[model samples]
Target: MEKIAIIGSGNVAWHLCKGLQNEHIEISGVYSKTFANSQAFAREFGLEVYQDLEMLNKAEVDLVLVAVNDDQTARLIEQIAAHHKVAYTSGSVNLKDIDHPQVGVFYPLQSFTKGKKVNLFEVPFFIEAKNMELGEQLFDLAWKLSRKVEYADSNTRSELHLAAVFANNFTNHMYSLSKELLENSKGKFEHLLPLIFNAVDKLKNSAPEDIQTGPARRNDEQIIAQHLDKLEGDKKEIYKIISSSIQKKYHEKL
Candidate 1:
């Protein structure tokens, strides 16, 4: 029964608390520089929020999970590591640079939004530790919350984070753009839900490059030009770049 204390109240911290508590981990307490945030979160979790970091220092915690911003992670971890085993939830930061032997990474590889319902059991947790002992402790904790726990070094975790930005952030922005385009044309974007869902379902069975379609994949110059002509500004630029890339890829196949 290793007790855990979470620092920060951002999306990652919120979701991590949810998942960890469900797995019966004692989120013994919470800490935040913003007093209101810590108070609110503590109320929700029915745990007291320590107003002073000194108070947190006095508590017994087997692990301190820091979910602060990337720039602040190292500083927070360093401070907490003096008396506690600390892990920062950051994908891009290298653990090697942190000189503490009790410091590690406990990054949850998923996009999170505050107040959104997230199924963390399906989300991957990437764990890294300063040594084998802390590594096992972190890995075992992650495994309790998720079926997709795995070990990833700093370099690999950073690359995976980059890939996630492309796959999730950029792709979601494209969807938002599509919705705006449909609204401008007097159409509801919900009509595209079936198409979007089907495409996602198809990818579960086939690689995207193998299942490529559309005028760009067919190298239909006329249709591509028409589509480009219909778009303008950043939209047109994005369309041209993606269309050209698709055409170049499949053309090499021929």
Candidate 2:
């Protein structure tokens, strides 16, 4: 059984620990800067908590997984000695830029939220390692948790992360705006659920451009004006910008 130690107590660390616990891996310990968070995580997972990471440094573990913020990743990586095989779970951060021999990326390309259960097998793992052997090992480990595991270099990973922000973060923000728009109005956000689902289902079998149907895409200036009149401030600006972009995009094909 492979032993591993985690270096964080956030959402990623919790999910990583929980997922690995079901496998043949043994979680040796967990360390965090905050004692309350670290203690709480250790208690939940039945693992030892490390206040000073030197104890975990000396411990015999096959790998040390760092699931900290991008800002904290370099600090933690520098603290971990060369003797340990270290892997970080950051999507945008480049592993090549970091000065380390036994370091790699174990990025999972999916949004993680506290209390929300994520299907690990459905989530894709984008992996990159410092060397061939380490890459292979990281890939193997990722494959254990996710059926969809692929090799991605730092640059590719960063680009993918940027795309993910557009696809997930920006899209979710649009949903939030929709929900806000619905508040104190004639309908609730629930009214859009079926429409949203249909749009998503259509995307499975059709390209977005092919199925693009909206006042913006069709250049329906009347409806567009009505929508713009309903919106205010940043929302109105966002609508105009997107509508203009959509009209321009469709016009280019003609």
Give each model's whole-structure lDDT: 0.88, 0.90
Per-residue lDDT of 1-254 in model 2, one digit per residue for the tens?
28889999999998888889877679989999999999999999999988778988888899999999988898789889898999999988888678777999999988888668999999899889888888899899988899999998899999998999999999999999999998899999999999999998998999988999999988899999999989999899999999999999998679
Clash counts per candidate, in order, are 0, 0
Show model 1 residue runs off by greater than 4 Å.
none
Error of 1 at 106 (Å): 1.2
**lDDT (tens digit, per residue) of candidate 1 on 1-254:** 37888899989999888888888888989999899999999998877787877888888889888998988887776666476888999989999878676888898999889889998889899999988898988888888988999999999999999999988999999999899788767678999999999998999999988888999988899999988888988899999999888988989768
**Residue 139 displacement (Å), model 1:** 0.8
What C-alpha root-mean-square deviation, in Å, does candidate 1 show against the real structure? 1.5
Worst 10 residues of 1 by lDDT: 74-83
| Model 1 pairs whose backbones collide | none
TM-score of each: 0.94, 0.96
